[model samples]
Target: MNRKIYISLAILCVLVLSLQAACFARTPDKLPNVKILATGGTIAGSGATNTTTVGYTAAVTPVDALINNVPELKKIANVSGEQISQIASENMTNEVWLKLAKQVNTLLSQDDVDGIVITHGTDTLEETAYFLNLVVKSEKPVVVVGSMRPPTAMSADGMLNLYRATILAGSREAAGKGVLVMLNDTIHAGRDVTKTITDRVDTFRAPEIGPLGFFTGDKPVFYRAPLRKHTVFTEFDISQLTDLPRVDIVYHYANNTGDVIKALTQAGVKGIVHAGTGNGSIGKVEYPAVEAAQEKGVVIVRSARVGNGIVARNGEANDDKYNFVAGDNLNPQKARILLMLALTKTSNPEDIQRMFWEY
Candidate 1:
């Protein structure tokens, strides 16, 4: 071989290696990146092999495994999974919520991050989703998803939930819609989502409002939009998710005494929800303690404990006399969610009531 040809071949080999390195570059400016923040939900959960009927530890399951199972996702977007925590939904606290929020806030601050997907347990997911819906300040896609079954189930559902959620997070249709809950292939606005099923994969229903859309293949199609002023997209900030608000709920019983409400307030609660027995009607004796709480600045929301039905208002004679906001159809927990989010804006009862109505 000619000596000059040998030098040319060496230079060609160096250029090829350089191109390979550049092609595999991991920079956000160079490659498309979407942040996948994992908070333990059934989607990332693992239950004992013997217990295969859906109950499992949230976040104990891994997103990477789900991604590997759904290889087709590579065609949609680059995915990187970061485990925020692994805990059951009932065990979630304001601290964890704030941590998740911080992760989302940080990702949104990064110009390279195009969107975010959070894997959360379905139990408290609606509330958490609602929190982010009102607080995160980006128009970029922010999606939350969970599973009805654990990874060890006979046919676990986490893999599909994560895939559809990722697709929605990377889709333009989900942007400016605030946080979304993508589950069972349905795209739900965090604000109106409710887990309507006790035990089924097809849970999480929006009876009042239909789903935002459905995730088809590697794409998301929007059919409706949420009509509420939620977090992040709201004109306010709920970084207050960090402060664990002391909110309590009292369920009404036949001849219900007011002790529970008084005791909870005496126990140092900052807010309370009256799970009125019927139509948000409080027992006659229960009014005084609640009234005292209101006077003491303990925010109150009138909710129903019947499991279903709206808490309608009639001149506030029963509840408004005590200065409470009708929780509409929102149960105790959901009402607490609204109160928490509302408190971030103002402590005024009128403002809080208006927030509940509009949101």
Candidate 2:
């Protein structure tokens, strides 16, 4: 065989391979044609050699395994998965939330993808969902699903939760509901939902503020939709995160120490959340340090150390004078979450408060 002819044949084969790869990526043969973004939650896992499947981690389950385990999904929609991360939700960072929000926004601009599903660990599920709800620009459903137990555990709740989330994503009824947390058979607004129990299959609930709805026999049943305003797919692109100002959380507790207040100021933290005691109250001991930190230019937010209900300002004097803001109904931790996101848009304490009110 001539050497030149052999070389020419190899080049021709390489070109064919490139074309084939491109065709597979762009072709739209998959069903209901939905997109599932997997973030390495318990819903996409199996049991280990021991532990009765109760404990789980973001292991090696790819996107296909989720659909394959629940073949009944085939009758509902044509879905595909994009493995985004494998870390537990507790470790999730602002950067990851921003990235996820941007990715969903990009997909929503496409004409074919009907909805987006996020599979996440239950620990910080609400935070991720809320982050998406506040930022992803779409009336198309962006549903977050997680299981209380690992799939290998007996009576694992992951499968049913996944099914419910899938139904919500495919249904036209879920439009304009914002990002949702579908777990324990309930559909909760992302920011309003929280994990009430660490071990129960029904670990998620809406507190005094209840779920928006539930799944009844593969159907989404809505009772009350949230009336809050959101800014998804708006000018709130996460690409703006690069130069965004910082936001921090300050927790108020009985005799709360001022260590964080002093530390954050040194770290140049631009914002602070005080998870205060009753009604976002700060202890006398911690107040001066926080006030001093704020005097130096940090935005101080008073949030409840308690987990439930809206936090508010009562007799806490000079809160307005000191340019401090109340967390409203958000816990200190959650207040931190919303504040960081809001700070991406503006620095004025007043404007940041309004962003919270609107969202």
Candidate 3:
């Protein structure tokens, strides 16, 4: 009687195992399609030795190698890759930004491509992410991911970061969340996320607003959504443009003479983002140069060098008096991006200031 009971239990276990196998086999068809647009960064970097995280050659690895290195990605999404560029994020240029944005729009417009994961270097990842956030023209999930450590380093984080990014891009929960920057398992809004630490793995953070979500399981778990305008809601369109208007950032310091501002204006930049002191204050020494540039019809946006805080219009500096636009919560680099796009539509300070607040 005992032997017969054991036989029955064994048969039941086999039936359960078979059912699980069948379910697993059918999961691929149900998985979301995710496309990886690889622009080279530290995530694609390689080092001379395992401990050599710094001074490593970046953009050494191709998109296919990155995908194939992580086998787990196959279980969560139907993944494919395309090489966008093979340069470090610091070398990221307006030409590449235009190309990337156009390609992203083209891909997300297709029905087959459900979402996109962009592999970038941490140096300018935030900038690229913010650029796409405004111009992607799709509600589909777009995740920008990178690693501080090279793939060959000890406890290398690239493959895992890429995997989590793939999961995020393919997730239904990640849709309509704006472009996201994922690193160290944290998901941040592209417009708000910035690299806070230079060499650490947990470098990216949204200082004032915090992260949009995190990767908790097979899918990304959300805690909040971005309140700022982004993606499909933005008015900046770049479809016909071959190049963006030249915008430059000028850093402010004690006794600064604003020589750089004058040079930028003479060079014919359409706009300038001043990385001013607290609350976007212009040094008394440099004020005239700023005014002179503004007189030339070069848009001057006052952005603070401080990491977190709003550069309120008419606060420390008299924006109304100077005809200067405040940078809102955007950092200097991001402010430059917005100013570039803003120049495309209107040069009016009021119209551009409204964009500073809205976008």
Q: What is the TM-score of each candidate against the true structure?
A: 0.84, 0.86, 0.92
lDDT of 1 by residue, 1-359 (tens): 69999999999999999999998664444434677887776766667784566545556656567567777667667888787887778788888877888778878888778889888888888888877777787888898888888777777887777777776887667888878888888888887788888779888987756788886765688887777766454655645445756777888889888888888878877788888777877777877888887777888888888767678875334555556788877778778877776766677777777776777
Off by over 4 Å in 2: 1-31, 49-53, 231-235, 243-245
Residue-wise lDDT of candidate 2 within 1-359, one digit each (tens)?
A: 69999999999999999988876453336444678898877776677743565655554577778778887777677777787887777778766777787788888889888888899988888778877777787898889998877777778787777877887887788888888888888899987888888778788887898899988888899999878865453345575564446777765555667987999999999889887666667777887888788688788877776787666554453567767777778666567777777677666888877766666
Model 3 misplaced regions, further than 4 Å: 1-26
The positional error of residue 197 in candidate 3, measured at the CA in angstroms, is 0.7
Any idea how many clashes model 3 has?
0
Which TM-score value belongs to model 3? 0.92
Query: What lDDT would each prediction earn against the true structure?
Result: 0.77, 0.77, 0.92
Which residue pairs in candidate 3 collide? none
Candidate 2, residue 351: how far the Cα is off, in Å: 1.3
